[model samples]
Target: MTAGAGGRPGAAGRFASAVFGIAVLVFVLAPLLWLALRAFAGSWTYPHLLPSQWSLRWWSQVWDTPGLTSSIRLSLIITPIVTVLAMIVCLPAAYAIARYRFPGRQLVLMTIFATNAFPRFGLFITMASLFYSLNLMDRMAGVVIVQLIGTIVFMTWIPAAAFAAIPPSLEEAARDAGAGALRTFFTVTLPLAAPSILVAVILSFLAAFDEAQGTFLVGSPDIVTMPVQMYSLIGNYPDQVAAVFSIMLSIPSVLLLSLVRRRVLGGTIAQGFTIR
Candidate 1:
């Protein structure tokens, strides 16, 4: 009942919260920091927080690996193609679901959610047999198709949410002005949902960049991704792994998102409605 006693409990609660937050952060970051530290360490045959020596030797060796360059190139090429294909397929599909009332809508939604329950191995094994029969294995087109199947429902969600948020009056105004459906969709609908479109594009891009299972199943011997290449290198040259690829993988995400992270946090969802 005393004011001083009440303040004591509040202070203790704040202190507990701070300690809990720090513990969680340390738990999540410990492995990553350890890996980065080990990558820079010289003569570290054992894993430890602090290394006995430090050198850039591992970094240089990672570059000299035979298939590393080809693997990187393949990833760069495949990610964009898959991303473009995903957007093309998901956008119109999302718009239709969001704008129109149709039968089987619940089934469509249920089907999308159900897909995430399936294991990657189950899907890939079936795809492998079908693709092999069609002679499409290990090809770029096959990689795109595989990536698209997994991404269709996921990429559709954000854009549908984005499109649904737009006021119908805006599109109706375009129609009243004698604009055709196709013209209004491109000029009015797409621009109105640009913010969500950006989010969809980024998510799909990251998904394509990180995809491995489908790529492994259908990607020809000729089409290797960075993750697959990383797996290949892990056994043969474990030391070289950290020096080159970890930093490479993380750099783009940091650099690209750094500029827009504030907007993400600032609730800039309103941009979806601004045409310009």
Candidate 2:
């Protein structure tokens, strides 16, 4: 009787979990599947759930589109640049937050978290005017610098938390043995914190890559990106644009996230905040 009750509850829990998973999948997959079908069908009607006919006319045109290649190149260039800069800048910033005791630390962290709370688009005109004065307008370098300002907090904070989770005494031990700060960082801190950094880099790349408002806010027609191109394509050719660019825009991130997601989920960030 005891064994049967345990088995019954386990079976019920499994059924409920399965139902919830299927519901979530349907919600996400249904629209994407519809988009995939319609993109191949070369149709523009959206009120209908699915298109009746299917064709490859729109898919072929994706290659011939004039500005498509440029936008792709620009995005490919900018995403990695911002990710690299964010990672490099974040190392010291993370170290400070993790290891140091300073005035205004909580206030600074609060301010950084607050930036992600609000929509960054509200600052478009102000950011544009600021970048304009700095001569970043229409330049790839400018976009990178501008993106750097916004992404720094996310890039650093989580990694800092990861670094902090390591007992500080480890570093002290390394130092007592005569390792310098930089050497300790590379040999001890970095190896331990590497997976966190990888997660941060992937997150930063996706954040900058998908930024419609920031990209459009400071971006020009001269420097096109994938989302910018997709936006323009929506205005002109809504049919095929979703198909080709979906793969282009999605693959890098999907591959990266798949690799790093295990680390991210298993990370110290998963345990929530603890400042020491």
What lDDT would each prediction earn against the true structure? 0.74, 0.75
lDDT of 2 by residue, 116-154 (tens): 666677766677888889888878887787677677766
Error of 2 at 263 (Å): 2.5
Per-residue alpha-carbon lDDT of candidate 1 for residues 185-252, written as tens digits (9 for 90 to 100)? 98998998887677667756776777777787688577788866666666677654644577676665
Regions of candidate 2 where Cα sits further than 4 Å from its true position: 1-16, 42-54, 267-276
Model 2 is weakest, by summed lDDT over 10 consecutive residues, at: 267-276
Residue 99 of model 1, lDDT score? 88
Off by over 4 Å in 1: 1-9, 45-48, 256-276
